[model samples]
Target: MNTPHTAAPVARLAAATAAIAHQKRWFARMREEVAAGAPLALVNADAPQEILRAMGIPYVVNQWWASVVSAKRMGPAALDSVAARGYPDDSLQYDAIGLGSMDLPAADVPWGGLPRPDFVIAECGADATRKVFDLWAEHPGTEFFPFERSSATTAPDNWWEIVPREWERAYAEDRLDLMTSENWQLVDFLTERTGRSFDIDRLAEVMALVNEQAEWNRRTRDLLAATRPTPVSVNDSIPAVMIPQWHRGSVWGRDAARALFQEVEQAVRDSRAVCPGERVRLMWIGRGLWFDLGLYQRFQEKYGAVFVWSMYLAIAADGYARYGDDPMRALAARFTGFTDQLYTPPLSSQWYVKEARSHGVDAVVHLVADDVPGSAFTTEALEIAGIPVLEINADNADSRGGAAAALEAAIGDFLERRVLG
Candidate 1:
């Protein structure tokens, strides 16, 4: 008989486990609220959710929920639901999974599934994202709100340094103005629909909380970057940083970030190592493989190769944190071209190279999702920096194509031939 693998106690962090438990409880409460006729908002990952947070509206992030669906092994069935509605099942699986899950039977839904949201909000980015959220509006009692997606007219290499205090220079003024106006519009729309009052002072407080949260993440990221024989796994750090990220404007979110920083600090102080044999430190540059998190750990035992960096934790450290006297504009500055930092050329390519060097990574595995832009530039820049690159073309959410085996094989080959050699 074969035995299933279980993580050793030290390999898992209590902070990651607690975050998961808290999210489940939070979701259960959200479901109950919706059942009692409270309104719910479904916002995209790139949309400004702090507005919803400050207004006291209950909300769920579409991408976060999609991650949950994918992690539960329900991605194929959810995609089937989308196809049943005559939508393109193969496109934007990360954003579309939430819409598809709404059609699934209750028994099949993950985490008892998402409650039917009264409002769907997203930035009108890409050709398909608007269409996906539009489809969401077609359901009864659901309305869609969109913010204009603006392109980055200027690229700044040192965004992480300037964004916290001097955001106007990091992003164009016109882009910030438009998003700030739309944020007010969203506030009005929510107020009219839900009869909740908006307070600018309250928003300022929320923004401060979010910035504090980002600072803690920065500390954790810096600690991990400077540590050798990496202290924590990317798997643990992802949830530890990202679960609280979905609740960014709250006290709990700020504290969660602090807890993660403290936990990693303690681990470092104790000299805990994910791979004590630690020959290679690798970077994962894409959406997490939600269905196969174990992929992060697979090479550790055989090759002493550990995935020490992922964009989830790294972006949380460097991408968030906007400070300004005007709360609404600061919020706008935070989201306008936010995706550009990770997906636009020059900016995306530059940041990835910076992160690679800072983390001291020997190699990178860039999971190339079809929906993400400027991927080629990102891969090329890392190569120019003298980092060995392994490109895997795969959907981070869907597992339907039997691609996992091929992906694993490709990575193994890359490790043996390029990285290990």
Candidate 2:
């Protein structure tokens, strides 16, 4: 349980980094901290794990765990084993699980002998995440606190259909900069020994590449949504993996899109799932299913419908791929700061819909969030394309709120009218 590497307090910098060549070494260090009693806090999937590492805390990832919990319809059960600490229930399941994990004096959920987390850091960026954070905080004795700004921008204005440019001022709320500054401070603490300026340009570059990545993402999405191009399963490509990669942006993000594009082209060539001179290829635009993934199951399988795209995945593929070599500028251009007010121009529904049409989607399932500014635009643009469109309001993760009912009605309505008219 001794991480002789990071534990040397301050004098062992050189020896510590030298030993970091292997991930096992670092995992051992984190394990040592957990065994010593530090609780773990898990937030969003796109959360930068390095933040916890830089702070020397032990935590588990929530995206996969939440996916598991939601899929099983036993959200609380997942955290019982990790935090065992109870949390506020009227919030995101993520927070509930995280709070429960932190409240637990010991691992109570079910992962067997795995180390239990001592704390929880949940978020409210979207619905699922919001609850994840709130649940963890209401409980006493658990080290849960409000995650200041999990997203780059927070001003709700930027969240909608037309994110006004002046609204860009809202980017200042991002607290990650605090963590980044602190990490660099540590880097500076060792700079005399290591002799470097804690170059953050790489991270900056990481941000910039999102534009090109976004473009490519859009291309792939469009191709997949085409009438007879690529036939991808929502369960296969959209749900399981691409979503996680969407946020990280760049090398891997672009690569995934490229591979997906190639797969689409190959599928089209094979003439398998795609109907030649075909009928319906639609876009499923909305928050993805977390509680039950079967949201689009009936339409997809029964209708011989090919769903080639989802929003975030498409955004990353299209919004990112713009940067050629220099990416920092691109990152600053795209996500210098963003928060989920989703009502502003950044809500960019027109952009998304246009991109959808360009990609050949026959219609869209625009899951409208009353809060998002341009969310309604998602449906309008699709209908304009002469593609049958449906506006549904199922919370991606919170079925209890309205999604379950909305889902049944929407699917029925979609099949009945065949178009929103």
Candidate 3:
């Protein structure tokens, strides 16, 4: 039996989740068109999606698909699919889970399984990312296209402040040049393969829509941060913000973002609280806890601690905005070292501390994955800034590494000892 709190994900979140269902169904229908020689691309989240939107190519983001697999509790089976292929299931589980799950029986697959991608597009974010996509291309129908990820040469202390407006100065010109050139090459590559002409005007329109959507997200994040008693839960905000994020540059995505902001603003007006007796406010610094979302609400009734923040919503606010004349260059600026600002040492640490203080977070639960770049610095920075942080070492996608009971107990002990103490 699903309670209202559990069954009904907040309204905005419900809309986003429903939109994903609609997208999957639409993908199912689109398969007929794909069979008739329409192109479908499997894209990594960091890749430029605006070009695909403008070119009328349908794309499925790899990370989003992996989250779907994790949430459906098929991660073990998904990893097993990888192990069976002689690949180490433990390595890059977050990025590789969807690839592994591709071989699952139709009934066993989540969301009817992903369609065979005509193109597998990714940036060389890690040593294994391109290789993983290369494996995907080994299937008869798929081909791979990769963009270069430049080394992190610049380390700005307060990235959240500068990235939204002064991004050109924040990142080096050469880095932007490389990404912009690569984006054009991507456009050329897609054009030659799909027989689709790249339209600059259409791309400009997509860029504008992306900016509009991101602005709405910034407003929503500000509204949530300022509102006392937190008008919505992170569990709800995650899907509400993320679904639109994955579909950015579409009109529906822009409307969804605006709708989320309005809904959250309305909730603030109503004094609605997910935890009415809310006491300790927490910040979650890591990926979404897909295996057990209920963990967020677990302490609410017992200790009045409601998780008020997560990187999904916060990064959606700060990470997506870019402004300039050339849409392609601006788009390049958006993704060039995009992940670095979130996970690199000085940039990541500074942003976390700033967010914690601004959100009035009492403590932080930092899930430190081995693959994540600067977990130690993020935690240390928070503690140095007079915030209590409880660091847990585990993969966010694989819950089997640490039992949920143990994880929950550790959190309870942290709250009792460090936070509420």
Candidate 4:
């Protein structure tokens, strides 16, 4: 068995540290703003946050807050609270955790708990997503805004290449048209409710900044993909990329992306490796296991395995980045089929294969969540491309499944029998 190298404890990246600090400060400010009568919006991960940013409304992402609840070890209690309300706690836990967290006492909540938002926005994509937001809207002083999620009737194989420039051809025009109209409706809703005018030019600026940020992420991902012995861990890269992702369309977000790129570049130049004896490169596909991030690094000492790729960073590289003259339509195109690219058929499967080959992935540990679609196709595609896959069926946010121990054992078994063999 390989042993971890006796190096000084790996210092967390300054970019990641600073990003967390900034988020703490930003959250505090958001609380203060909401207290001062400024409206707060709680939006789904796929919702257009740029609209809120451009309109100057304070917003918190529902999925990010759920991760916080899960990471803080409050997920089980939160889910229990959901079940006590006669709702199915096992369903859509990732989307519903924030609502349940709202019921927790202030002392038990993470980061002093999320303040009740005036507006809750989400795309009604999944079966239970609308129901989750509906419960959120039942809270006092909160209203729910739902965007119509259209199915992908057509998606080309070269989606990554086309989505950046020729997006009109990449996604069905009808789908884009629908989301664009809904985005406008959201703009109108916010404008009417808060008296904050929607400025298309400001949204254009936000979109431009977002594209610039995506470009920086692409550079960083390419550098990490090419670097041997992986200079950064997925644990570090996830927060470093995703925290800034929730803040996308801002100058701060753009700068944070650049900072991460520079930090990674510096690490690569200095030859810093997350696992000096790394013998296996692993890709993690699905929502992060917020309850047990250490799972990502666990096999390193015994198996010389390190999780080098996650969809958080990979999607930020290829999934974002839209350039067009019409910012509204461009923004719609960016999100219209975004989830489909990650969760739909041949698109998701093809992209995972491409990503695995690009990163030289030795194996994959795909966390197959109940809510996500096309996971089997993704795993099959990777296996067909001569890569081994270990699928774990569990909720990423909820810990009720006792996943930590079982997951570790299963991954260990996979490393011994499948990957290392």
Q: Candidate 2: where is the Cα deviation over 4 Å? A: 1-41, 45-64, 76-219, 225-229, 239-258, 274-278, 300-302, 320-343, 369-374, 380-388, 399-406, 418-421
Stretches > 4 Å off in candidate 4? 1-10
**Tens digit of per-residue lDDT, candidate 2, span 363-393:** 6777664334466554565566577777765
* C-alpha positional error of residue 97 in candidate 4 after TM-score superposition, expressed in Å: 0.5
Against the true structure, candidate 1 reaches a TM-score of 0.97
The superposed Cα distance between candidate 3 and the true structure at residue 311, in angstroms, equals 1.0
Task: Report every candidate's CA lDDT.
Answer: 0.90, 0.46, 0.84, 0.90
Ranking the candidates on lDDT from highest down gives 4, 1, 3, 2
Q: What tens digits encode model 3's per-residue C-alpha lDDT throughout 180-216?
A: 9999999999999999988898988898888899899
lDDT of 4 at 287: 92
Error of 3 at 266 (Å): 0.7
**How many clashing pairs does model 1 include?**
0
Q: Give lDDT for model 1.
A: 0.90
TM-score per prediction, in order, is: 0.97, 0.61, 0.94, 0.97
